[model samples]
Structure formats: C-alpha cells, structure tokens
Target: MRDFHLLIDVGNTFLKWGLFQPSAAGGARENRLESGHALLEEIPALPAQFAKYPAPSRIVISNVAGTRVRAATIRVLEVWPDAPAPYWLVPQAEQCGVKNSYRNPAQLGADRWAALIGARWLLGPRAAMVVVCGTATTIDFLSADGVFKGGTIMPGVGLMLRSLHEGTAALPDQGGEFDEYPTQTVDAIASGCQHAQAGAIERMYAHEASHVRDLTCLVSGGAARAVTPRLAIPFQYHENLVLEGLYRVSMSL
Candidate 1:
C-alpha cells in the first residue's frame, strides 16, 4: 500500500484532518485523498481510524485547541505504527511564500496562519480577505503580493447566541433559523447573530475593497456557511484551507 501524508487542524471545538496520497504524475502529490472533522468529544476516536492505512510518510498539525485536546491528540498520534515525527506548525514571520504581519508572528493562531498560507498559495497573486467563522470569526486580509495584513475577530454565530443567552436573563442558548423578519424570539436571536457575523465580515471585506480591486473573500470554519449566506459581500468557501495550508507547509519543508 502507498504511504500517505497526514494533515491535522485542531480548532477550538473541532479537529479537522486530511490525508494526501501520491499523485499519478508524481510531481507534487498535491491531490488530497480524504478529509474529515470531529468535534472535541469525538477526537479520541479520530486517531484510531489511522490504523486502517499504512503509516503516514509524514504528519503535520496546526493545533489551537487547548492543553486537554492536545493531550488527547497526543494519545491518538501514538496509535500510528512507525509514523514519522509530527510537525507542529506555528506562525512565523514568513513561510510557504506568505509574509506574516503580526508584530509577533508567533502570537497568531496556527490555524489562521495556515489558512493564510493555503489561501495565498492556492490563489497566487490574487488579493483577498480570509474569513474563518468558527468559534471565533476571524477576518484577515491578504495583499495581491502574498503579504498578510492582519484583520479582525469577533464572536461567531454560536458564540454570539451563547453570549446573549448567558449575558441576559431569559433568552435560551439554542439554535434558531435566520430570518429577514423574525416573529419569534428564537429566530430573532438567530437572525441577530447572523447579522452580527455577516456585518463584521462585510465591514472587513469592504475595508479590503477600499485598498484592492476585484477582491475575493475566502471563508472557512464550521460556522462559515451559516454566516456566509447572510453576507452582502460575495465569498468563496474553502472547508479544508487549514489542512491545505498544512499540506503546503509540508511540501515546502
């Protein structure tokens, strides 16, 4: 059996991973063979699935989940027989041809750093905004030349809903439909959350538009779809951006 390259992204509430196999032409092995995600609770089951395949030729990960999840992930990594050492990705001032703008690049989330790298690498010389709307919605800007200009972050759909419910006296923390005109309190809460997320994205996108022409907004993360539909600015969704970024980093090294 052909050996594989594994890519992992550990987010706040979920773990995302992708497997890449060698390509037919065998130049870059860029084609992703499989990918999946699991919420924090389901992570332990995640690594065990690796046994079905040959040991990965290499493993790379970008983790933002805190210590508990990291510890659990370590347990799973141990499951791969004779697997290569795992490469934990961190944000550097420059890597994979993307330049980071943070005063201290290491402070940026590894997931975001990967997304920026993946986005720029995928859409070379095309200026765009990278928005990841998961537990926290992050809006980062990329110049056409592959320079990462830092952006903003805010509460995502679920977090927005939770904050309102937890901060207030009566609103329940539950899912609701996004509506133009909500007749019920639940829909009102949901719609409000959507509006908040979409508005922040649009604002950042508009700011980017002010500086660049024909800007494309590249969005990802669990809540991305929920928030994208409500956005006034158009956006392209990339579910495996972080994973793709990890892949790119691996190729570079």
Candidate 2:
C-alpha cells in the first residue's frame, strides 16, 4: 500500500492542504505531516508543493465552495493530467467508524464531518464536543460510542464582526482583536463579538453536559485562539482537524 496521502480542505476563505505518511508500528510519534494555507485562486501551486513527497496514489478532498471545486479540479488536471482525479468526500448519514445523527444527515457541513472523525481519533470514542471556529463556527457532538449526534452552526467571530459593520449602522468597522475585558468602543465591539461567540459555545457545552457523562471539548480553526481563553471547560486544540479527517478518510478506503 502507498504510504503517502494528500488531503485538501477548501473553505469559504482559504484552502488548507496537508501531506501525511503512514507511521510504522511504534513510530506513530515520528510520522511526517506537513500542512499550510493557500488562497482559493492559488490552487495550481499545490502540485508543486506536493512534488516533494512520493507520488500519492490517493487524494482526498472536502470542498465547500462550488467555485473552488471547479477551480481545484482544473488545477489538478493541469498538473496531474494523467493521474486519477482526487476523490471528493461528502458527509453522509454514516461513514467508516462514525454514524451521523443529524436531523437531515447530509445537510451537515463536510468540515463538521471531518472534524468529528479527527476528534474521535484523537479524543477516543468518548462523548466529545468538536468546536470549529472558522468563517462559520460549527459545534458538533459525538456520543461516547462514536455516534455523531446533531450539532450547532453559528456565524464565526470574523463573520459576526463583519456582519455587525455591514448589516447595521452604529457599529464601527473594527478588526478582530479583543481585550481581556473590553471597555472602550472598539474593545466593546471586539469583546462583545468574542463573548457572544464564546457564550454560544458555552451554552452548547452545557446542553451536552445534561445528557453525556464525559464531555470532551476539541477546538480548532482560525478563530480558536480568540475563543479558547474564554471557554469554561478544558479543551484540546487541533490546528487542522478537517485536514486530518480528510487524511483518515482516505486511509479507510
């Protein structure tokens, strides 16, 4: 079996790519994994970066944007024109080791599905709450038995800040940076947006605590640093859960 894998996660704002090599027994800690960010328009650059690794027989993708999907396909064709097109992973009601419990299972975001997969692998099959704070904040719950119970979706910190300025009149157009306890106008906007976002996560944790015995929180994405300090529960931080999930899915097939 080929030991190399390529994982791609396309989001609303950026494209994240990761390369992973299977670990030897007892070599898990030394496994090689490389990842970085790229603009949606810069998809063509991926093939060159990936050239450093052995030619990957398997490529997995979780794309959220139609435009990005089209562009990425074109770029891959331009470079690996003869190679097999990458397999796209869409979240379903059930998949390799996890079952979705969403009201309409397919409606769950692909990123959420990937996060749940990666979270289960890291946190074990315990009751886990995976919070991905990116362009959109997604809070997904996986039961102790590895069942993906339905989760929540809310506007992310950046989206909320942007919305406040774009949707309303009084709110100032401030960048995303909040003080420990905001007091000024800008700080107020920043802190208000931060707390509001963090508050929603807190509520979700509370809601899950009522039903699950052991609630493990896993936080990831661009906005995690902004919200982690405010979270009440002890949580694990993963910089690229979606990408890791993509890698895991590819390995299963």
Candidate 3:
C-alpha cells in the first residue's frame, strides 16, 4: 500500500537506516518496523535488505559521507523504482522549530542538523547539550527556545587512537580498556582518549548550564559506550537520533 517511509543516515563510518510506519501519536514517535546499519564497504547489502519490504511511499536521507557514498546509496536504492525520489536533507537556517545559528548554515553537517531537530523534539523547551560520538565527536549546545548556538568537533575515540598509532612510531594501534591510572601504554592511550571525549563534553555542559537553567545532556552515536561512562554529569543516550530527526522531516511531507 506504499505506507512506509524509509529513513537513511549516511554517516562517515556507517550507513544506518530505518523503515518506519506513521504513528497515531506523532511523527517524532513513529513506529519503527525494521532498521539496519552497515560499514561503508557493505553498501551492496542495502538493496537486498530493502527487497524484503514493500515499496515505501517516501524515502528520507541525510548524507554526510561525501560523494562516493552518496552515489553508492543512490545506486542501491534502485530496488524500489516506483518510490518517489529520495528526499536529501540539507541544513537550513531553521527547520522543524530549531534555528541554526551557524555563521554559514549550509556548511553545517546534515547529520548534526538532524540531530539538533531530534533533540528539540525529544527535549521540548529544555536547554540541552547534544553530543554525538561517531567518526568525529560533536559537542553542540541547543537553547531551551530551540536555537542551535554552535558546537565543536574532535576526533572520535577510535580516530584519536588511530591518529596516535599512525602518527607515531611506538604507539600501539589497538587501545586497551579504560582506566583512571594505567601503568601500560595501551591503557593510557585508551583512558586518555575516553577522558578527552568526556572532558570536552563536560566542559560544554558546564558552559551551557551557566547560561541556562536545567541544562540537559543528550548523547548519541557509535562511541557512546566508550565515552558515556567517563562523563561526570547526567546524560540520556539515543542510538538513532539522526534517524529520529529524519522521520520528523518526513512528517512535513
């Protein structure tokens, strides 16, 4: 019946997607039917996955992986020839109630922009610090009134460890478990990377808390497991915020 809406988030390290059915409540709370994710190399599996479902009425996408992946995604999406052209999300000055304060709004990543909208939907009017730990760790501040102030990005946990190993001669490529005080170099590297992510998030949280009362921290992305434990403040983890944001966008159509 072409009732489904497919949501895809093409991130730097992975391409994640969800097939959702409209909710009786609202779009922000849409019912997810099936979801899957794969590394960049596994793009070929997408068509097979989607083949199991009926043709969707609409396709919503947020791609930040650049041209090659964008082309790859478009290629795989040929499985549903009858579906409407995919809606590629582009960040704007404002969308779905969240206002982007980027000096140049177009330069902001679609994934980040979507996450901000999702955060606003999830958190309502509360001030929030949205932290995403993926290929790059992003720390963003969203005011209670739905304005996206600005944020910083840094190398993610694996990226930090990889850079140390690749850029140096003696460092190990694989990091050890997180430890406060480690005598081993592997542990030190792992702990340092984790702490760096947590420290930056905490600092941003504190900064936002100073300006707004009852600031919330919403954490998401692949590396949330490694970094969330190190955070000293309270945070709510969402595994598919980008998809949530994409679904919200799909509601507008």
Candidate 2 per-residue lDDT, tens place, 176-239, comes to: 4578776677788888878887899999898889888889888999888888887877788888
Residue runs of model 2 more than 4 Å from their true location after superposition:
1-3, 24-30, 44-54
Best by TM-score: 3
Assess candidate 1 and give its lDDT: 0.84
- What ordering of candidates by lDDT runs from best to worst? 3, 1, 2
- Pick the lDDT winner: 3
- Give a tens-digit lDDT track for model 1, residues 179-245: 9999999999999989888887887777778879979899888888888788887878887678778
lDDT of each: 0.84, 0.77, 0.89
The local lDDT score (0 to 100) that residue 83 gets in candidate 3 is 77
lDDT of 3: 0.89
Q: What is the lDDT of candidate 2?
A: 0.77
Question: Total clashes, candidate 2?
Answer: 0
| Cα shift from native, residue 37, model 1 (Å) | 1.8
Model 3 C-alpha lDDT per residue in residues 1-253, reported as the tens digit of each score: 3488889999999999888887645553448877889999999888997787878888999999899999999988899888789999999999999999998998999999999998998889999889999999998889999999999999999999999999999999794988888989999999999999999989888877887899889999988999999989999999878988898888877
